[model samples]
Target chain A: MADFATIGQQFVQFYYNTFDVDRKNLAGLYRDNSMLTFESAAVAGTAGIIEKLVSLPFQKVEHRVDTLDAQPSSEAGGILVLVTGALKVDEEQKPMSYTQVFQLNPDGAGSYYIFNDIFKIIYSAA
Target chain B: MADFATIGQQFVQFYYNTFDVDRKNLAGLYRDNSMLTFESAAVAGTAGIIEKLVSLPFQKVEHRVDTLDAQPSSEAGGILVLVTGALKVDEEQKPMSYTQVFQLNPDGAGSYYIFNDIFKIIYSAA
Candidate 1:
């Protein structure tokens, strides 16, 4: 059995680190079949996902994760991770609330690749 | 092949409708192996999930979905559905933003059940 808690923690750390520093390097974490839903747009495949991430409006961004939850999703050892966090973009004074989910599939080896990712920025209800 | 978009739309509609009207009836959509992460708390199994949900602070709530995204997650025909919406609890004047992810596993009988669910309420960053 896999230690999903540790895996989820490590993945969250690595993902935010890479996303904040070098987003292009995050491509290796995805495969050709991967899909990313950013806000209302859905992008498919590694190239598209990376392109979308790299093309975000902000030049600099940081993610501060508040909660992380993981669950074994499939009989094939897929992991579902949910994260609620705050994101600071550019020179923004206050961080924006965001929620993201990642579906990770074991690559038959000791590693895993992202199968699906969805991210959304939560606007204030007021 | 499963029509993930249609399935996601129908599932979201049914889920929120059941949740707003009679949350106890939503138990049929989950199984023993199901897990739900509400905010920072993790609840497992149908009974626990229902208890946690029914015990929420609000007397009445309504969800208005803003975006819905779905991706085929596994070879086993699981679907990953992500929803960004707003929730009005009781007599609150402003609806709070919320994001929820649901992993639906296809049962052998042409139906699907919730394998994992995570919900979060987004607070104002300002």
Candidate 2:
């Protein structure tokens, strides 16, 4: 049921939804084994990923994903999207720049998985 | 003529091929405007890509792409591969660890273009 066009829209919402923490909504987007390998941390499963979002110290975190190209292999039951964008992290004063890649499993429901995701974060000097 | 399986195989060969500079061979992989948005460098076109490869200061650099899942949309003429791996860089003494995502163009002849590529570079403690 999930096609690349549908998958692409979800991706945009997924990244931009960080504008405000929607725990319940966000949780629905991932699979049980939705591994999140961040630049500084790698967390496995939905529980682990939940912990990171709940424990983040930042007052505000903004992630913008632009220039997206997605490929959803209906036969393979998975999808991949490449996003050229930036992430603005506050409180810790991190660089808000990045080019990101997200791999998703658009499965029937919650069992979907994120096999891999790669992002380049750029930081500014004080 | 290129399928996901074929594209996947080429992906591995492409990354590993970087171990040694193969400009002519590498040149055949991308489209005319194959934009490369590296962690630190952004090069566009075959000429630009070639120029970057020809001017690297490092004596040795290694890129390892593992755990690949590729989707080639024969209907779309584009293939996207999600790779979980690391990059080892020398001379600059930086972190070689990373999880990368590559968007490739497996077009006819040399007509393919990379829409986007994102990589995370992990640096070691000094």
Candidate 3:
């Protein structure tokens, strides 16, 4: 059995660090079958997801995670993680609220890859 | 193969309707293994989830969904649904922004049950 809490925490830290510093490197965390639903748009595959992420309007952003919850999703070592956070972008005075969910599937190499990702910016700064 | 898009839409409608009209009935949609993360608190199983939901601060509430996205999650016919919407509670003039994710797993009876549910109120009325 895997310590899902630790894994979830580690993944969250790694993901936000990579996203804020070097977003392109985050592509390696996904697989060909991975899907990302960004707001209203759905992008499939790692290439498309990465492209969509790298093309976001802001050049500088920071994520402050407020809560993280994880659960076992499958008998095959899959994990489901849900996160709520605030995002500060482009020298904005007020941080926007956001929610993200991730489904991680075991890759048979004692590792996991992002199988499904959903992200939404719930509240925008006035 | 199940029509995931239609299933997702129907589930969203049924869920909100039941939540608004008769929240206690929502317990039937979850199983013993089901888990719900509401904001920073995590509740497991049907009893805990229902208790938490029914004890919420407000009595009269309505949900206005802005976007709903669904994707296939498992080889056994699980669906991952992400929803972003505004919630109006009580008589507040301003609606609060919210995000919810539901992982519906096949119940082996030609139906699906919520295996994982995460809900967060991203923005509160000012």
For model 3, the stretches where C-alpha displacement exceeds 4 angstroms are A124-126, B124-126
lDDT of 1 by residue, A21-71 (tens): 989999999999999999869899999999999999998998999878888
DockQ per candidate, 2 decimals: 0.73, 0.11, 0.50
- Per-residue accuracy of model 1 over B20-51 as CA lDDT, tens digit each: 99888999999889999898689999999999
Model 3 has an lDDT value of: 0.87
Sorting all predicted structures by DockQ, with the top scorer first, yields 1, 3, 2
Which portions of model 2 miss their true places by more than 4 Å?
Answer: A23-25, A91-95, A109-115, A123-126, B1-20, B24-100, B103-126
As a whole number from 0 to 100, the lDDT of residue B82 in candidate 1 is 87
For candidate 3, list the clashing residue pairs, or say none: none
Clashes of 3: 0
Worst 10 residues of 3 chain B by lDDT: B117-126
Question: Comparing to the true complex, what docking class would candidate 2 get?
Answer: incorrect
Model 3 lDDT per residue over B17-116, tens place: 9999979999989998998988868888999999999999998989888888898899889999988888888998787778889999999988899998
Candidates sorted by TM-score, best first: 1, 3, 2
Q: How much lDDT does candidate 1 score?
A: 0.89
Per-candidate chain B TM:
0.96, 0.68, 0.95
* Angstrom error at residue B65, model 3: 1.5
**Chain A vs. native, model 1, TM-score:** 0.96
